[model samples]
Target chain A: MMYLFFLTALFMGWSLGANDAANVFGAAVGTKMISFRSAALVSSVCVIAGAVLLGEGSSEGLNSLGNIDSLLAASIVLLSAGITVMLMTRLGLPVSTSQAIIGAIVASNLFFHEPLHLESVSKIALTWVYSPLLAFLISFALYAAIRWIINHMRIHLLMIDHYNRILLFIAGAAGAFALGANNIANVVGLFIFPFEKAQVTLLPFFPRLSTQLFFLGSLAIGAGIITFSKRVMITMGNSLFELYAVSAFVVVISSALVLLLFSSQSLSQFLQHRGLPSFPLIPVSQSQSSVGAVLGIAAARKGWHSIRRGLLLKIAAGWVATPLGAALITYVSFSFLSLFIDL
Target chain B: MKLFTGKNKMLMSNIDSFLQLIGDSSTYFHKALESYLSSDENTFTEYLKKVSVIEHEADELLKKVKHDLYAFMLIPDTRADVFRFINDLDNIIDSSKQLLVQLSIQRPLFSPSLSDGIISLVTVNCESMKALIETASVFFRQPSLVENRALAVIRCEEKVDAIGERIEREIFSLESSYSLSEKMQLSQFNRQICSLSDLAEDIARDLIIFALKRMV
Candidate 1:
């Protein structure tokens, strides 16, 4: 029964991998700086490593928004998020897995009559906006600095090409790692702590059940990358960003750094110890940060006018629609499922 | 790392060799014409053969560089610009070889009195080509200097234009010393030689644009 419910969380992970992996390596593959095969392989491996190793921070943050203590509630939340992502996508409605999972968790918490952690919820909400803004600022400075360094280096064009290929590969890998580290929480965070006592001896290397769950979730994400990410990498990567190889490098690295900033527990501790403002560890949208990074490049090339107001409106619309759509579906389904099962 | 760096260096060397051949072809074409004007027919024949060889070598280098560029998918962003620039640069050697070939076959005796004007035109044309070569060589390494060198080509073309007009005057006025057919042949050579500097100037103009568009 538990294994059957676990498939929903895997579906969320798979959907994320199919779509968001392009945010990391799409430009590289589109520019032909990196082939799709190498990109998918490196991305799949790094995502799993990041999820198993550093995915705990955001998982805790996501759990705080609405902690689901019961197995039935946790599985229900995961199923709702999975359904919302697929259904909304099928209807051509804007959706993000991060937003969908949050909405589903909120609905399940309401249905169970559990207290909401409004402080943590607000903090997580703030990140949805701040992450992209921070990416814009970071990439703006990064692009200018990189452009200066490359110009001053006076490298030959062919040498620049060779070096760029190497740098893009590294950036794409880092972006994948960061994606897994931050977003893996959204895939299976609710289920991680609740199932900590389960005796699962599948992996001798990982003794903790949370690690086992994260490993399983990341495998789904990895499978998604291997099976379905190529078309998205080719279509969405360059079409959305339209970046040159150099701009792609800057955009990817900036977004990766943003994801890392939010997901790394040690980095958060380092900042908190120094009396610096540490960001709330949360799973922000990778696709949004990538867009922000691209906007930063556009602003650097032209002025602020380069940012299209229409696109901003669409983003705002998605921010509202994705979560609301998921919340509405989760709420209605929970109400209906309550009559059929004893909770 | 070493593998890619080594490939980049080898590609750079191939490009350098190609550009050098263009330079050598222009020089040999001018030398062949100067020797012929000075009545050193043997030296003219040798230099004519030299220009032909240099042009062939340049074509080979072009083919190799293009093959490597596509095989490795290098400089994806700027490769099209590179392909265009190199193709135009090859035109310099092509035109030079054609001029040399025509000079070898025609052997139309250029009079000693008009040698000074004709030699002046060749010198100015060579100067224009040299400026274009300098501009192109630095295109990848130092784009900032490309526009400046391109300006120098323009200056040389202006001089070539002025000198070509002066030579035209000298050739048409030589009716007393030569027949009408001889004058017409001399005029045709003058037009063709002056056209070389025009080609150089056109390529130089495009170099400025290519330089501006270079990705760092």
Candidate 2:
């Protein structure tokens, strides 16, 4: 019976992988610099490593949002978020799974009369707004610096081409690792409370049951990447303004840096140790960060004229609509499920 | 396998071969024009055939360049720009072939008075083409020098334009026994040859734009 509830979390993990993997290596695959098979292999390994090793940081904030003691309610929330993401994806809209999950959790809390963690919720909300803005600023500065260095170095065009290909691979790997570290929380963070003491070692070599669950979630993400990310990668690679190899490199790296900044617990602690303000470890949207990076580069190059305003407006609308739609869906679905099941 | 491994060297070699073929085609055009002026029918016919063959070879090289460009992952930054540049350069070869063919079909006689201006126009246009080729080659080898080399092409084009206009004026003022239709044919020939230089200048402008993009 517990296994049945776990499937919803796996479904959510799969949806996150299908949609967010493109944010990591879309341009490289789209430009035909890296084959789709090679990208999938690298992304799978890195995402798993990241989730197993460093996925805990942002979950602290996520867990604080609302703790649902009931497994049935948690499953409903996950299912509602997954279904909302799937619906939005079919509608050709770019919605963040992280945002959808948060909204679903909030709605579930309200429905059950659970105490809302207002302070943590507000902190997570602030990071969501800051994440994209920071990504844009970092990308703008990084691209300008790269452009300066290219002009100063007087590198041959062929040599620059070779260098960009290598750099793109490195950046793609970094982005994948960052995606796993930051977004694994969105996939499995909500269930951690109920399963906190439930430990089952699947393999003799493994540590505990929680690690196993995280591994399973990461595997689902890997499956999503292998089976479903190709079309989204192509759209991201070609539909956006014609990204030169250099610009593509800058965008990927800057977005990865933003994710790492928000998700790295060690970095946050180090800042606190130094008497500096620590960054909130929130599970921000990788899709938003990637789009922000592109917009930053575009704005740096040619201001508003270079950006696709209509496409961006549609994305903005999707961002606002995703969470609200997921919350409403979760409310309705949970009420319907309560009628049939003893919650 | 060889094409995949050393793509930089292969693209450079292909570009070199394409430039060599274009130069050969331009030379054949000059020889054909000179033979026509000297009234050597057999030599003119030989040069026309040579120009046609060289143009065909150049076209083949262009096709290979395009095929390799699409097949292998070469320079991603400038690949599209380079592809468009090659297409533009291909036009010069086509114009050279068309000019030779026109001379062969019409067989327009040039008065001795107009001969010097006609040869000068062709000479200037060929020189412009040669400079443009050099600039394009330099663009691939050393992008920093591309802007400087492109300036030479611009200067050569100015000379071609000036000489072409003078030749047109000379054709209209001819006091020899020529019919109105013959004069019109001569004027048309002058325009066609001059059009080659204009094409070169247009290509040079594109090269400059490409170079500026690299600089940025």
Candidate 3:
């Protein structure tokens, strides 16, 4: 019976892998620089590695958003978030799973009469707002630096092409790792609170069962990538203004950096040890960061006129709709589940 | 396995093969013209067959170059420029083939005065194509030498144009011993031969742009 509740978490993991994996390798696959088969393989391996090793830091942040004492409530929240994400993905909008799960958690908190941690919620909210803008600024600066290097170095065009492909593969792998690290919390963090007393040892040398569960969730995400990410990959590759291979490389690297900064615990601790303020470890929207980086490159290349404003507006609309849509779905689903199940 | 092989080497090989085929086509065009002027019907047929074969080979290489460019990631900055440049070079080969075919079919009688000028135009155009091939090859190896070769192509094109125009003027200024239709045919043939040089000049100009892009 307890295993039934875990299915929702796995479903959420699958949804994330199906959708968010596109953020990691979409540009590479879309531009035909990397084959979809290779992209999926690398993404799955890197994402699982990231989730198993570095997932705990941002999971701590997500855990503080709301503490749901009931297992049923946790299952419903994940299900609602997963459903909302799946819906938005079907509509071809790259909505963030981080936003969806947070919205679902906040709604479940309200539904269960749990007290909301306004400070943690607001901090996470602020990062959501700041991440895309940071990604844009970083991408703009990075592109300018790269262009300067290319011009001054006078590298042969063929060499630049070869270098771009190599760099893109590295960046895509890093981005996949960052996505798995930061966003695994959205899939399995809620279940951690309910499973606190049910720890099982997977390996004597490894940590507790909670980490094992996170690995399982991440594996489900990888399964999702293998099974259902091809269409989204194609859409991402061709839909936006034709991305040059260099611009695609810049966007992936910059967004990966932004995701890494928000989720790297060691970086935060290092800053804190130096008596400097550290960035809050928060789960940020990889989709927003990727789009923001693309926009930065576009603006740098042709100014605002070159940007596809309609596509931007549609994505922005999906961003606004995601959290609200997930919140409402969580509220309604929880009410329905309460009639047949103990809360 | 394919990725480990340097794409530069592959791109260069495809380009070299394409240039070689274009050279063969130009050779056949020159031979066909020589056969026509010397009234060797059997040799003209043989040269026409050779031009046709070389043109087909050039077309095949062009298709391979295009497929490889799309399939493998070449230099991002100049991939499109290289594609357009190769396309223009292909046009030069295509013009040579078309010129040979017209010469074989029309068999326009060239007056002795126009024969020398026509031969000179073909020779100069062939030199222009040869210069372009050198410029392109140098562009891949030593970009610094491309400018001098490209200038030579321009110079050859100008000579071809001068000879072509003079021949046309000579044909029109001929007495009624040449029919109106015959003079028009001669003038058309002269323009067709000049067009080969014109196409080479266009490609040379594009090569200069590609070279400048690389230097910057």
Candidate 4:
């Protein structure tokens, strides 16, 4: 049972990598700044570092999903959620892995008559509102600032172009780090407490086996991105909007900041007291945040006329459907699996 | 017309004929339009023959650029855009030739501003083309100078637009003692110069857009 639960977390990590890394270097590849191979190599390293360093916050959020004592049930939920997101990605519909996992957890709770935490559920829903709104406001400000600098400084184009490349690369790295730290829970959260109860053994040199489990999850996520992120990168970069390097950088950084600010538990608790809102670390799909940023930048530059209304509607509908769709599939799969296994 | 095939002789041969033809024709077209404006019939006749010959030579040069584009399949650099730029220069000459031919044939009196507007439009295009030619010739030797050359070309194209718009407005307001048919023909002649100027501007814009895409 212990081994099966660990394997379930690994599968979840793979889905997280496939769906989320698209946010890190998708725009850069879309704008032809770097090739797919370079984006993969850069993002993989930075994502791992972010997970190892700042992945703790979301690990707690993952704990709120309730206990999974039956390894068979958890495995069913994991397999169903993984297949759902992978199929969506293959079809070029950018679905959220975080949403899939949350829905699965909710469905798993339904099977046992466990009450859902309305606070966590509401936080998840609120992210849907704030992410796009924040991205729109921030990108508008960034573009306006860039235009003002260009007009006032009268900087030489050659010098600016050279420097802008370096700045874009660094921003790309930060975006990758933010992705890992904020998104690690989508992979390893289910197994965090489970691993401790199971007494998973590791080398004596390492103090805690949980730290090793986190590293393993991050590594699996990196592998998933390296193997299958090219298609998503092209779809995100080219389909939504064509971007300049500066605009791409601004969107990527803005997305990472939004995730970082909203996902922090302390930040959310502080905001709630002051009548400001916060979102759950879970279900804040990086892809949705990125799409919002791109739309925001496009809108700020050319007004609402610049956006493709049909595409925006399609994306919004997909956002609502992904989790519900995944939950239904997982719930049915769990019922069928329970007839065979008596756990 | 020399038969020498040595390297130095060939280098001098290509530069002397092409450069001199372009340089002399650009100057002649510039002055012929001015002479036509001032109603200096003697000056117009003296420069007309030279300008017509220059236009023919420019046409032949453009044909070579087209031939070179197909012959060199790889296109050492962005020679297609350069060819397009040269074709625009050829068009400006073609329009000037037609204008001169019409002026001699019709022999109608014209408003001073009408001729002045046409002359200024032609001058702007000629100056822009000269800068473009110089930039393309030195591009390979100094690749790092792409932005500078591109900015200069863009600025020159804008000036051509400004002058063309001025000329277009002048044609509508001109008063002439010619027949209605003659006025339409004169108006069309003025339009040809402005359109030719616009053609040059389009080529320059295409070249700059292409070059920037490649460099950055």
Candidate 5:
């Protein structure tokens, strides 16, 4: 009964993986530049590597924001976020796991009478704006460079196809790695206190207990990719945007760079030690970053007129609604849970 | 990177050979037309047979390239445009086959004055095809250079059109001994020969637009 609570986190991880895996490999699979099988395999393997290795920094940031010390409390927080994602997606509303988890964490902190870390909250909110903007800028610069190179090279059409396939695979792998590293925190970071005590030893081998939980979380994400991501990936390829192989390559690379910017401790440390401003280690949404990267590409290819202004406004609205929805749901759920069990 | 597998390399070589076959077919078309004008039946038949054989080989190569492109290897993004122009080259080969076969079937006796004009028209068509093939070849390797090569084709097409008109007028205004039906037959043959250059010119114009995409 006690351990059953972690299953919610596992569910959260699964959903996160299923949805975000598309963000990484969707364009490649959709464009027929990469096969679904190759995309899934590379995403799974690299996701696990990222979760186990680079997942630490962002999880620490989530803990600073708020960590529920009790298993029941942690489960409630994660489940609330999971339910919010599922409900919003079902309603065809734009949703983000990062916003949901942050909202749930803040709600849980309020429920437990813990002081909210405003600094961490502010840092996270800032990244919500910065992540996509960063992705857009990165995509713009990368697309320009790639376009120039392709024109100047004058390679045979077959040779260009060969290079696109090769580059798309490598970019997909990097995107997957960044996905796992950046997003594992959203899956299990709230359960840090419980995970710290309850060791994860049986599954993916790792040195630290959090690393093991990340391994477990990443497996669920990998499972999500294999089981449910095929349609999502193909749909992304076919109708969502119809990205060319080079465009897909650029999107994935930009998203990965944005995620890495938020998650890499060494990069942050290097920036801080040199007195340069560093992005806070926060789990920004990969899906949002991808949308931003796409917008950047559209803007670069055409101009601002090319960007769908309606979609931009809708996503901005979702940013506000997701967190408030998760917080409201978590607060109400806490009330319901308290009636049945002591907090 | 090794760049291409053995299978892909073979496919690429197949595409190259197909373009070469079109060029070869153009040469044969010229030879066949020249021999027919000279009334050398034996040599005309020989060149016609060569064109037919090259047409068959080029078709086989086209089928393989089409298969490979559709099978998800070559027919990706901008490459689709490249293949479309490449596909147009096959039409050139087919035109050569049609013209040679028609000549072989009719074997009309060309007037002595008309033979020179007909030969001049065929020469222009040949030059136009040469430039068309060059435009396609450059499109694959150096698309930036395709504009000049394609323009060369258009220029040849202009020469072909002028010669074709002069020949048609000459046939119609020939000596009173020439029968009306005989003049009509020669005019029809002249028009068919000019049509090949027209096809080349159309492909070259489209290639310019496609090659512009490749540049920026």
Candidate 6:
């Protein structure tokens, strides 16, 4: 049964690599700055690097839900979440795997009446509201600043372009790294807990299995990035704006800052200790923060007409629907799986 | 009518060549402008030749840049912008050359201050471009120098703006010997040149900010 769950997670991660890759390119491709192939290549490398170096936070979240006590339950939870995500992917919806994982844990807990961590759940939901808002505000100010310097100041054309390119490259790379550091746990945390419980040798030379799993989770995300990321790259480079390097820098910096702040484990722990409560480790969607920042920049430039309200709203709606729909599917699937194996 | 006739085709073509050459000369002229304004005219004559050669080369390369851009399988990432920049620079050259060609052909005497102001702007513009190129060339090695020079370039634009205001006043105060149409055409031409210099200055400003990763 545990094996089935592991297989399901593998599928989820694979789909994630294919689906979420679109977010990386929407802007780059739309602007004709990069071809789909080039965007894919860059994103894949960056995503893989991101996942391996930063995959810790989400893993911890999966462990705290108390769903990893037995191999069978862990397997069920993971399998159910993956299946739910796969369905969402097929429908072309950009949903958060973090939300799916949490929803599954919540539904699974009902069967045993597990003492639910309402505090953590609330914190997680709060981030959903805060991350995008923070991104929008930061990007808005940055763009306003950039426009002012370009218009009001005296300068040369070529120099401005060169500087913009350099800044964008640095910020974009940082954003990718942050995405990996923050999102890796969404796919690997469930599996890691069972290894910890089984007392398995994480490494012959080292006894700490959790750390090993963290490394593996990060590597898997990196692999996902390298193998499939063209679509998302196009969406980012082009569809977002007539992005000069300055605008690109602003968007990347804002999105990365927002994701890192919310996903940082030390910060989360500190918040929990301060009587603010904890949030589950879930990959905050880079797509959300990036789009919010892009829109913020565009609004600063051309007012509301600059925003593609219909498309942005559609994507936003999908974010809301993914976890809800996934939770329903998981609840039903688990119910069916349980009927076959009487506990 | 005589200008448009077949017998004068050679003359028109010569004029076309001159206009094209002047258009192409801006980038190189900009380089010379940089050298001259920086008080370093060690290679002023060489700078002049380089500007001249660039125009000659543009005549040689124009068909090709146009043709290749059309034929190439343009990587989606690099297509629009590269072409846009090249074309825009080319248009600036064409307009500048045409202005000179018209003056030579018509031999209409105009206000000395307006022409002097235009010439001065050319100097300021060259300063801006020089600063931009030097800053770009040494950006990674000395970000601050690039930034400082870019700031200086931007400051020079203010002088160009002041000159523009003076030129506008000159236009309104011109004597009644010339027809309103002629005055309008000449004023519009001056305005275009001023606007172009301002745009070049704006581009320089953007570059500096881009390098610094912060707006100054």
C-alpha lDDT (0 to 100) for residue A136 of candidate 2: 90
Q: What is the C-alpha lDDT profile of model 1 across A37-74, one tens digit per residue?
A: 88889999999988988998888888888667666777
lDDT of 6 by residue, A1-343 (tens): 5555555555556556665554444444444444555555565566656655556676665556665566666566666677776677687665567677777777777665678777776767666667667788999998898777765554434335444544554565566567666766666667776766677764465356655654555455545555665555555555444435466668778988777775577777888889995544556777677767877887887787878877577566755676666567667766787788763
How close is chain A of candidate 2 to the true chain A, as a TM-score? 0.92
In model 6, where do residues sit more than 4 Å from their true spots?
A1-4, A21-54, A86-94, A152-155, A205-207, A231-238, A241-245, A267-282, A303-316, B1-55, B60-216
- Candidate 1: chain B TM-score equals 0.92
Q: Residues A1-343, candidate 5, lDDT per residue (tens digit)?
A: 6558878888888887788888777767876665788788889999999988899989998888866778888887888888888887887766788899899888888888899999889888888889888999999889888877777887776676677667777788899999889999998787667767665454445567788788889999999999999998888766542426577778888999999999999999999999999989989888788888988888888887899988788778778888988999999999998898888
Separate DockQ for every predicted complex:
0.40, 0.28, 0.25, 0.05, 0.36, 0.04
Ranking by lDDT: 5, 1, 2, 3, 4, 6
In model 3, what is the error at residue A52, expressed in angstroms? Answer: 1.0
What global local distance difference test value does model 5 have?
0.83
Report the lDDT of model 4 for residue A6. 67
* Whole-model Cα lDDT of every candidate shown, in order: 0.82, 0.81, 0.81, 0.66, 0.83, 0.59
Which candidate should be chosen as best, given lDDT against the real structure? 5
Model 1 residue A67 CA deviation (Å) reads 1.8
Docking quality level of the chain pair in candidate 1: acceptable
Candidate 3 falls in which docking quality class?
acceptable
In candidate 6, what are the lDDT values of residues B8-85, reduced to their tens digit?
A: 233223334433454446655555544543445465456665654555565555555444434432222333543443
lDDT by residue (A217-236, candidate 2, tens digit) is 88989999999999998787
Q: Which lDDT tens digits does candidate 2 get at residues B1-216? A: 221366666766787889888788888888889889989999999998998888888888898888877776566557888889888888888888888888889899899878888888888878988898988876765667887888888898888888888988888888768888999999999999888888888888889888877654
**lDDT (tens digit, per residue) of candidate 3 on A100-152:** 88898889888888898999988888787678878888988888788777655
What's the true lDDT of residue A259 in model 3? 85
- Top DockQ hit: 1
Q: TM-scores for chain A, candidates in order? A: 0.93, 0.92, 0.91, 0.85, 0.94, 0.79
Least well predicted 10-residue stretch by lDDT in candidate 6 chain B: B1-10
Backbone clash pairs in model 3 (N, Cα, C under 3 Å; residues 3+ apart or in different chains), count: 1
